[model samples]
Target: MTSLDDLPIRDDLRGLTPYGAPQLDVPVRLNVNENAYRVPEAVALDIVQQLARALPDANRYPDREFDALRAAFAGYLGHGLQSAQIWAGNGSNEVLQHVLQAFGGPGRSLLSFTPTYSMYPLLAQGVGMRWVPVPRADDFTLTPQAVREAIAEHDPDVVFLCSPNNPTGTAIDLETIEAAAEAARGIVLVDEAYAEFAHDRSRTALTLLERHPRLLVSRTMSKAFAFAGIRVGYLAADPAVIDALRLVRLPYHLSALTQAAAVAALRHSDAMLSRVDELRTQRDRIVDELTALGYRPYPSDANFVLVGGIDDPRATFEALLERGILVRDVGLPHTLRITAGTAAETTALLSAMAALRAE
Candidate 1:
């Protein structure tokens, strides 16, 4: 009569708490950095129409290979089938887990920068791979020297670099990524979940796929394409790497609804880009306002801004929440990250902050 807890589990996950975004139902929700707008009515109708037409076969399993969706995704990215390697999963998170399964193991290591996406370390732990982090410079830039040193020292099997990094919103330069790719002995994974919001062009790690067979560029429809709920994320890498992921991935990992929704979303890409531009403008305005308030907002190339050295970020976060504004308190003691919402939501957030300051 052994209790469930009495059984031995993977030692690595013994004391781990699950990772999650904050759950609050505040008026101006901004905790998760979601695109602050909903899919346009036309796009929504298009998706509904597509799904309605395809529901007869919805009872059947999705295409195991996801060939059509993959081709659509590659076409959207302007990459051909051979040079256009892709793999789909429930989310980019799943794609990342597959990456760990394929490359990282008990003896291997996963490398990344500190105060970046929190998922990298968690994913490494989940896969029983050692997690190694190198602190970024105070400015949140990855110096080539630091990356070289880390690669030489830990020699990780998988490296996760989040551009326009989550929580920090600072993007790594192409030179830094190139140096890291050159230095790594194993796979270099560039997580570009927030790339669309950035002013800089997406560093084409895809171009480097052939030369650096170890490089993988992971992307998601969640952020820019407004498809978070649909959960369609894909990875682009060398054909060999893509094939490896396909082998390790669960069959029919993406649902028919997800595929249909994703394809529809891509069809409405221009409309989505217009929304992204609006959000970027709102983000810039928020940053300027924060800076004028005497708070140092980190230079952001993403949908959110990270403000540090505040008096009490948690208190500030709570205060904002009390005022019906939701922002993320990243547990950095005196740092808070705020996502840019629509123009109206952004105005409300700033007004709430100003009122709180007056108090």
Candidate 2:
């Protein structure tokens, strides 16, 4: 009966826990910021058909280069991108892991603003890279001047900017990204996993790529595409950067079925994404509803809202869980982050909130 303490694991990981969000089986699940809508019927049918076609080739290895998926991704991005400028993996987390593997190491460091995607530091630590998280403003906003100061002081090997960031749902403008890239002497990665839910599509950091070779923009099919189960995430960057990632990624990593399924979904992206507007409506409704309920809901460009007002967030989370509506208690004091689930789910959450307040 050997325990973990007896086995010789890496000292850094000896006491650490794995990354996870609660996967509860409640009637209303607004915890992980997953798109509530199922994949469009047409797209699902196409995926089934395409995977059926690719199933025979599963006996052989998938496209080691994933060339077709890259071409489709280029078309999807449509800012004069090519397959040479793209790289992908099971999810954006894996893509970022590649970045860290290629550039981050024991002596090097990764810099990002605080209260960001909690995974950033974990990714760095997994590879023995130092994670330096600077604090954001009280409103959860990053300023260009602050970015310059951090870069000037830390001189990290990589900088991460999570736009429409997780937990807080705060979005950083391109100016801040530009400043960070210009000030830093290393790669600047923008995590745009929630970009499609933004009110203004033009706010994306993709537009600045032509001038900033150091910039990398990561996106995923999980959110607006309603394809979280399929696990397709990609990055747009300089051809040299993509080439470097090729050195780190495992051979034929993406399965043939995943590639086929992603291609099918991308071909019907318009139909697949038709629910975004409705989700945005629901997200805003949550923001307004929380405000009216005397909670402080941060303005969100993403699908979830981070609201603060609970007398005890942990207790409120337990109360909501008992009511069959599960939301995220992100360790922020008096705050809980919730996905903008379907209308019925939203109603359940609001009803629970009102009931708890009255109590």
Candidate 3:
């Protein structure tokens, strides 16, 4: 067998691991921050019908511009957005890659707060750009003063901010976003993958787009819409930003099926997002119950909670697995991050933790 070391891989990627979480066959899975609810049958049926219609046109390529899909996304986002301001890809990861390709490259750098979306640095490196991570506050928060200082020191070509940030699920204040835009002499990209789960959905970077021509906001259909398997992500920016992405994007990158699925899903957006409120309730319950159990869970605006105070995260992770539940050990000291699952699943997670403490 040819080992990776024996093959001619890039030196920069030699020791780095691909991004992923455990995909075990456990009864209760709270890892990966995916929406725990299944798509409603009515919405699923509608999507199947749309796919069926798109199959006949498979021989020909999809709408290269995906104009209809873009329009749908603009309608869904509704911060006075229009189709010209929207751009999409197979997933938000691809959308972010497009930004890096267009705005960042060799000799340039990508800067973001530490412990953000794990993929940010990897995406930067893949494009031959330098990745600069500035640590967040001790409580895993970022303030305006901190944002200004980091940008001034790094002077990077691209700044990535993950709101309702991953791992800790801490959201960035608008003031901090404003600070980054004002201080940086480059593109400001806000990865709002979890924005729908935030307590105040209106508090988004989309609100800042009119003021900051360089600001970019990315979103996905995976979480709130429970369309993860479909792989649809999009961006809203000044139309000029969308034009720049077009220069770097492959012709017809989004397949006909993906466009159909996403469009169909958005048509019934209300049904697709019906479970969001319930998921929010479960997330809050996790925080409260964990606190009562004497564990420390960070304040979360996303659909997950990052709990600390573990004697050994790996030990507790394995113990939870043994009890037929699964969570994430997100490489933070004495901490575990768990997705907000269904009510029954949340009960199982809490019950298992309580039992572990009793023992």
Candidate 4:
């Protein structure tokens, strides 16, 4: 019999490694950009209470339309419910997959900037779409001219921009997004996964909905809202674009329990806001300390900082691991991306760094 592994895979997916976050038993878990905190006890109890109220209906399938949860999400964002401008998926990552399904396929292409959220290319490959990347400037900023040129040259079906980008943690400006939207013949997706931690007000891209029918802005509750494990993400776009997403998404994509949890989380927005403030403060403290140690840390508006040019980043990573402190060593040589942990965890990292440097 022929071996299953001998069967031909999609050419685009032939050599791809499965994507995942690191798993290490460490005291300071700073590798993934998790909220670095837990849901408050009060919020946890309220979620339990809400779910208890729905226990009898637990046997029933979740709402296929997910209307109530969608409305709550839009209301939390201060957008109108009747506008048909929003969507939700298991995670923003899934939302990305749906976007690819809607606009990209075997013969089409997906475009994105490099050193961005790594998932973009993977998602494109999974859909059997061609993936194209344009490199950012050394400082990780996108130029309108370069973007316009790429749009004109490649004419891709989809483009993804991760603002306050992953790995680098630097944000692209509104002008860049708008210019990309104008120049592109296809969809322009702005992944604002870290927008809440940034200083700039969210551009929403909803504001440009009327002008750019193909624009979509994706957001996640995983980071600032401390809901990573619960898995909720949303998109804001023109009604037409959202309709396209709705067509491709799985029915009841948002579970009843998840909907309840997200609603409760949104209801306590004030408390979540407070946590964001605290995390931002901690992130700044980490940046200051790392810079004082002579490491070049990128100016970040997100919950993590990307510091590069360390000597032997792998050795540094290993040393930190030995001390029960975990941080991410991105593929770049001598560079590490550190997520902000609690004050105590941050102190542990600093201590580990000091010990490593002294050696």
Candidate 5:
């Protein structure tokens, strides 16, 4: 029998684990930070209709540029961005990979504050780029002064900043983003997958693009749009940055079905997103309930809460699973992440936590 060690693999990947959250068959699943609601029936039907239209033309290749989808993406970002300033891929992961492929390479480096999206370092490693992890403040927040110092120290070719950061749900202010950009000599990528769930659009990095051409912002339909199955993530940047990404992407990478499905979803973007306010309400409920349970909940602008004060996060996670609820144990000591799901799901989680704490 052959083994992985027997074959020549990239040395950087030899002992590294792939990124994944548990996919358990529990009743109240909040892991993976997915939009817990199904796409509205009318929108689902519209998606089907769009996909149906594309099926007949499956023999032909998809539009190489995905022009209409790009336009839809631009309209959604809405910082006066032109379609030329946007690019997308299967998911934000692939979109980030494209950025790395274009601007990051063997001799170059990618830098990000720690406790970020777990995939950041792996993406850099995959492309033979150095990954520099700068620790954030104890509260999981970054100060502009701290950001400036790190950029000056690492001098990386690419920098990643995540607002409403994963696992912690802390947002970065525009001032800090601007400071980081000013101190960096290379590309600054702001991952805003959770932006739509934020309190207001004023906090978004999109507003800084005209003044900072080296700064880029990436967004996803997976979260707010309930389009995780669609695998669509897009970015807004200078047209030249979009051009750089184009050079490295595979020909006709997006399938016709994907483009059509995304178009259909965006066509009713407002109606599709009508549930966001309700979900935001539930997210706040979780924060309050968790704090009331004697846990410390981070200030979250995203659809989930990163809770501390658990005696043992892994044990608490399993106990909740046994009680027919599931949440993410995001590898942080004594902490867990629970997605702000539907009203019912939120109730179930709160009830479960209350019961567990009493035991």
Candidate 6:
């Protein structure tokens, strides 16, 4: 049998594992931070119509620019954004990879705080860029001072700030973002994949773009829009930055069906995002119930909670899995990261945790 070792591959990737969350068949799945709700039927129908319209053009290549999709994204973002400033890919992962390919290279470095999106280091290594990890504060919050110091020391080619950060759910303040742009001589990319789940959506890096040409803000339709399966992600930056990304992007990267579906979803944006408030409610419920169970639930602005104070995280994770519930153990000692699901799913999780406590 052939194996990875038998083929010639990059030595840098020898021991690294692929980034993924468990995809087990379970009754209750609260892992991966995906939007728990199914896409609204009306919106789904409209997407079908759009895809049908696009099917006739399948023989021809898709619009290389995806101009209509870009316009729709600009209007949805609504921070005085223009279509010229937008760039997108199959998913936010591809969008980020585009940035790395354009701006990051062999000698350059990518810097971000530790315990952030697990994909950051992998993306850096794939591009042959040096990965620099800086520690966050004790509460998992990042401060302006910390941003300044890290940029000064590392002087990386790019800095990534994950607002409403994953696995912990701590949001980065605008002050810290400004400080980073001021201190770093390279690109400042803010990953706002969960921004719609934040308590104050107004406080975003998009507001800083007017003053900082090097700043960029990336978003995904997978979470808030419940459009995960469609694979749409975009970012806003200066027009010059978009041109740089274009240099590395594949020709007609986004297929015609993808563009049509995404544009149709954006057209019904209000209906697609109607469940956001409910998700926020469920997330708060998780925090409160976990605290009452004597666990330490960190303050979260995203639709998930990072719980500490467990005696054995892996054991508890396995127990939950046995009960047909799946959550994430993000390798945080004595901690487990659980996503906010529907009300009934929450009830099941809390009941299981209560029973675990009693035992």
C-alpha root-mean-square deviation, each candidate: 1.9, 0.9, 0.8, 1.9, 1.0, 0.8
Off by over 4 Å in 2: none
TM-scores of all predicted structures? 0.95, 0.98, 0.99, 0.95, 0.98, 0.99
**Steric clashes per prediction:** 0, 0, 0, 0, 0, 0
User: Candidate 5 has what TM-score?
Assistant: 0.98
lDDT of 1 at 118: 89
Report the CA-based lDDT of candidate 3 relative to the real structure.
Answer: 0.93
Residue pair clashes in candidate 6: none
Q: What value of lDDT does candidate 4 attain over all alpha carbons?
A: 0.84
TM match of model 4 to true structure: 0.95
- Kindly list the per-residue Cα lDDT of model 6 for residues 1-359, writing each as its tens digit: 98887778889888667778889999999998889999889989999999999998799999999999999999999989999999999999999999999999899999999789999999999899999999888789998999999999989999999998987999999999999999999999999999999999899999999999999999999999987888989999999999999999999999999999999989888876678888899999999998999999999999899999899999999999999899999998899999999999999999999999889
Off by over 4 Å in 5: none
How does candidate 2 fare on TM-score? 0.98
Model 3 residue 83 lDDT score:
99
Q: Give per-residue lDDT, candidate 1, residue 13.
A: 62
| Model 4 agreement with the true structure over 130-242: per-residue lDDT tens digits | 98998888888888888898889989989998988999988887788899999998899999888888866555554666677788889899998999998998888888888
In model 2, which range of ten residues has the least summed lDDT?
Answer: 269-278
Candidate 6 RMSD to the real structure: 0.8
In candidate 4 the C-alpha lDDT for residue 201 amounts to 53
User: For model 3, where is the 10-residue window of minimal lDDT?
Assistant: 269-278
Residues 150-171, candidate 2: write the lDDT tens digits: 9999999999999999989899
Q: How many backbone clashes does candidate 1 have?
A: 0
* Candidate 3 backbone collisions, by pair: none
Residue 279 of model 1: what lDDT? 94
Inter-residue clash pairs, candidate 1: none
